[model samples]
Target: MKARVHVMLKDGVLDPQGQAVAHALGTLGFQGVGEVRQGKVIDLDLAATDRATAEAQVREMCEKLLANTVIERYDIEIG
Candidate 1:
């Protein structure tokens, strides 16, 4: 099975890296760029054959270490 996890900061959280990118974009003459939020994508190759089990395992990984649940949220996709 393959699992992909998308982890991002929740709304209202400060994102310094995102802010830096936005500022840089403006400096480069990119116009009208609004708020920019950055996140991470994690792809995993798993041995589990069942989709449900893979999803559960990925979700657990996110909850435990992949995401900082307090200020970040995650979405999982399994194939």
Candidate 2:
């Protein structure tokens, strides 16, 4: 099974790194750049036989180590 995990900051959280990227884009002549938020995607090949089990494990990984649950949100897709 393959699992793709996406981790991102929750709404209302300040994203300074994203803001820096936005500013750089604007300086490079990109217009209408409103806001930017950075996130991470983790792709893994698992030995689990089913999507349900992989999904649960990925969710647990995010909650325990991949992300800071206090200010971030994560979603998992299994295939």
The best candidate in terms of TM-score: 1
Candidate that scores best on lDDT: 1
RMSD of 2: 0.7
Task: Assess candidate 1 and give its TM-score to the true structure.
Answer: 0.96
- The list of candidate 2 runs beyond 4 A from truth reads none
TM-scores for the candidates: 0.96, 0.95
User: lDDT value for candidate 2?
Assistant: 0.91
Which 10 successive residues of model 2 have the least lDDT summed? 51-60
Instruction: Give residue 42's lDDT in candidate 2 (0 to 100).
Output: 91
Model 1 clashing residue pairs (backbone)? none
Cα deviation of 65, candidate 1, in Å: 0.8
- Stretches of candidate 1 off by over 4 Å are none
Query: Model 1 misses residue 78 by how many Å?
Result: 0.9
Instruction: Put down candidate 2 lDDT per residue, 1-79, tens digits, no spaces.
Output: 9998898999899999899999999999999999899999999999999878888888888889999999999888899
